[model samples]
Target: MAPIRTFIAAPSNLGLKPPAPGVAPGVRHLPEHLQQFSFASRAGAVQTIYLEPPTYHGDIDPETRMRNADAIRGYSIVLAEQVQDTVRAGRQAIVLGGDCSILLGCMLGLRSQGNYGLFFLDGHTDYMWPEHSATGGVAGMDLALVTGNGHEKLTDIHHCRPYVPEQQVFCCGNRVPDESYVQLIRQSQINYYDLDALRRFGLPATAVQFLQLVETRGLDGFWVHLDVDVLHNDLMPCVDSPQPGGLSYAELRSVLLPLLSAPACKGIDITILDPTLDPDGRYASVFVDHLTGILQDAATAVL
Candidate 1:
């Protein structure tokens, strides 16, 4: 494998607001530290691309959600095109996101060439359909869309359904999954390691288990979607939905280290950082610090 090509696909339309007045100015940019891990910036082994988010307000109506979803899908299409072009040219892609929904486009882009496994780390299942959704927020429908279950436009992005078989998908760090969604997961063959399970199994061991499953399933490749809310809210409160009793910062690193080290892992999407929610920017800084370490380690391993 060649050096990793990092792309920060900032699709800010997920409707999270920036910090309110009187909040520190530096809070919003805390995650910028991630750029320091770029191989291009330091050792020149990692290439970085920062994508600007599309303009869309986060609203809760079906019409508004659909419209925003379309915009997000469109933006992802463009991003996927770039990702495909880069991978075709022989480079790995790492996408930093505006929200978890960006995974739809990132997956679409990767699957265009061949099948890829998915590792979804989030507080919620994000598998709720519009009808099942309590908030009717498109962000919650992200996983459902990618799995070919929601709005037609989202599922049909890139001219084909991008549902990697349920067996090929792994949902981790889910503390607040909907009951119906849990049933949906149980009915399907998808692998799920919720918060309690993660605590019992530990991140490295759990990650290894998933990797073994991927190998046994003969997956072509794998992508990781890490939502900051998967971390303990106290440590990473700058997300759209903050949950308690989540993974600790160290635990998160443990989970990601092995995945990042895996030869089959293709790309990553780090999402759900709401700067406005962080009063002191400490949360963003902490999350980014750990993320930067992972990127740096990945770049070193690949190099």
Candidate 2:
């Protein structure tokens, strides 16, 4: 097989979690998480870029329980530049994120390429508005912001609001969503599939549905977002917010392997897993093996 054009981006975790109650997340350890992921030797990756985060990572203001929007914007600017370079070079950008908040930067990068879609593989809806978000962590509101539902600082970054249109975006593997999110999605076109539905219909059917959307929409390509919290707590529990039920490694591979192989699947970002929680590297290794295995297979299939 020929070389798979993959650029691995490692960003800081300052953009990790929201200030939800009892959610003292450690997203800052993402660099460590990337270091331990032995994928370069196995996944056939070509290049890796270490994007630097600003000094003011986590919030200093406890009242807001979040960093200033200016800081968030700063980090995204740098992150976006990196992603843009990766896309412009016609390579796949595998962004190892600071948090889901950096998803904004990823979409902005893809927008530079063309009209792209998103396959949000996460546990939570992440569709809350800033006012409704209890803890001001942008992670909680990144999806809402990107979809043009929140404040301008994030939504209008690079003046690319509604980063991916609702019709082209799909939020799958969801196990948790607040009432507000439920109501919003009910009236919207964003495709959503909860864990129960995924289990019942299975990944093969789900992948076909996703591909059909791409074909019908005539999308330029699609980007994927994998928040590790989507994995079951027992199999992978080092994330900032650990929900009880989720997809196991085998289950995730079943869904991911097919999606990654699609030519229209342009890029991907993996987020929410924290290395600090896993002292023994047990969960971290699981994350790497599944990701690399699927990536390798995808590259091989295309070759």
RMSD of each: 3.9, 2.9
Question: Where is model 2 poorest over a 10-residue stretch in terms of lDDT?
Answer: 56-65
Tens digits of per-residue lDDT for model 2, 1-303: 433556555555555443454454566667556667765556666777777666544563443345556777777777777777877777777777668888888887777677888888889878776566665777877777777776677778878877888888888887875555567665778887878877888876787788888888888888889998999999888877788888888888888887888877777888877766788888788678878888888876761
- Candidate 1 lDDT over 1-303, as tens digits, reads 435565554544442332344332222232453443332343233556666666555444465444366567677787777766766766666666666667777778777868778889888777767777655555677777777777676787756785566668888888875566677666656688778887787778888888998889787778888877888877776666666778887888888878877777777777777555665556655565677677677666641
lDDT of model 1 at position 242: 65
Candidate achieving the largest lDDT: 2
Candidate 2 TM-score, C-alpha based = 0.90
Best by TM-score: 2
Q: What lDDT is reached at residue 203 by model 2?
A: 74
lDDT for every model?
Answer: 0.67, 0.74
- Relative to the unseen true structure, what is the C-alpha lDDT of residue 199 in candidate 2, on a scale of 0 to 100? 82
